[model samples]
Target: MRVTLPASGTEVDVKSLSRTNAKRLGEINSKIAVKLAAAKADGVTEEERKSAAEELKALLDEKEAMIAALYPDLDFEALPNRDVLALIAMTVDYSLNVPEAEIKNWIRSGNGEQTQAA
Candidate 1:
């Protein structure tokens, strides 16, 4: 799979995400889930929730990010600002061979009907 960074104009050759990276992604998502639950329980303001979300996203850029590992030349710090969205999308689509437009439609419609088997 390949991902292009819009800000830096760099193309990243991603050979399907590693199991370790998948695990890390899952862990981060779990943390977000917990935070969201807590925010709901505490009746946190939307602005506060948004701040927490921004901080969680910053975690993706901290240290040796999984996306950085996919690019041979760039480290986490070298990644362009606002380009992390591309990396996240590429990671989710890795090995699936799903077209970008289809993915976008799925996201828009929130319909998760599975493809029929042969």
Candidate 2:
């Protein structure tokens, strides 16, 4: 599939994640959740918090590497922040096969459900 960056309009060719890659992504997300939980746990020491932060950083680096591999031609460092985010969103949408309308609703409602006025 092809996605155009929101800011730069650079067209990127993206492939759906293979089973192995999707599993790896799930593992990465689980690790991040663990690190976040550790950081937020009651009676967490300062040293423990710092360690969790460092671990989270490393996990994020790995995730970024995976994303780079997925979008090989996309130059993330040179892209504007909005473009970078758009690419990530595109990746999620493509990888999960999420409907475009659902994504738009998520963006509109900020929590994936529409709000009714009082």
Candidate 3:
């Protein structure tokens, strides 16, 4: 995907473009460094890998929200949801070492529908 910068005809890949998302993404990327190290070790459990991916995906989606919020004039809706989600999932997989139960707890806490049940 491509978007023209404000007041400039030059076009750039949507990933390269930056607003608030840029900084948050940098943090995510930094976090991934730790994940990658863990993944390289031979004994990583399948659950760990899965949790890392999911957290990465969530962060990337968050980055999209940040970009959209910061650049309302830019037509971010043009970006494909699958692409964005996939990137986020991959990021979560590659970058974080969250325990699966912790993530599940977080998910449960945020589930509005389930909140009523409790």
Candidate 4:
């Protein structure tokens, strides 16, 4: 399947990722998750959280960097919304490592709704 990078014209073949790509994505996403969780759990006011979120958007560069690593041919260094693209990468990677049923369970746990067939 094709996954297009947000704010950029580049596209990635989601199903073409290799084990190495998945591992790299997992490592990078783990770090991103930590930062995001910490930002949300800091007990700050809404305005403060908004400020923190703006700062946290910088992490999108790291996500784009990982994608560039997986696809050397792509130049995503200047792309916008790297975090969104990175998320798509993670979903594709996770899908490859699990069965359809497990993916469905995972999605339901996240958004509290059953996922449609892939």
Clashes of each: 0, 0, 10, 0
Expressed as tens digits, the lDDT of each residue in 66-95 for candidate 4 is 555655665544456553455454456554
> Would you list the clashing residue pairs of candidate 3?
32-95, 52-92, 52-93, 53-92, 53-93, 56-91, 56-92, 57-88, 57-89, 57-92
Task: Estimate the overall C-alpha local distance difference test score of candidate 1.
Answer: 0.59
- Sort the candidates on TM-score, descending order: 2, 1, 3, 4
lDDT (tens digit, per residue) of candidate 3 on 1-117: 332333233243333334344456678667777777776678889998888777767865666675455435545566555444433432343235444344334333232232223
Q: 12-114 in candidate 1: lDDT tens per residue? A: 6545666776677767768777776766767788888888778666665542366666666765456665656655665566635666545434333223343
Ranking by lDDT: 2, 1, 4, 3
Candidate 2 per-residue lDDT, tens place, 8-104, comes to 7676665667778778888989999989988999999999999999999998887777777777677778889787766666676678988654554
Which candidate's TM-score is highest?
2
The parts of candidate 2 lying over 4 Å away from their true place are 100-118
Off by over 4 Å in 3: 1-25, 80-118
Question: Where in model 1 is the C-alpha error above 4 Å?
Answer: 43-64, 95-118
User: Considering every candidate listed, which one attains the maximal lDDT?
Assistant: 2
Q: After superposition, how far is residue 27 of candidate 2 from its true place, in Å?
A: 1.0
Error of 3 at 23 (Å): 5.3
Error of 2 at 18 (Å): 1.7
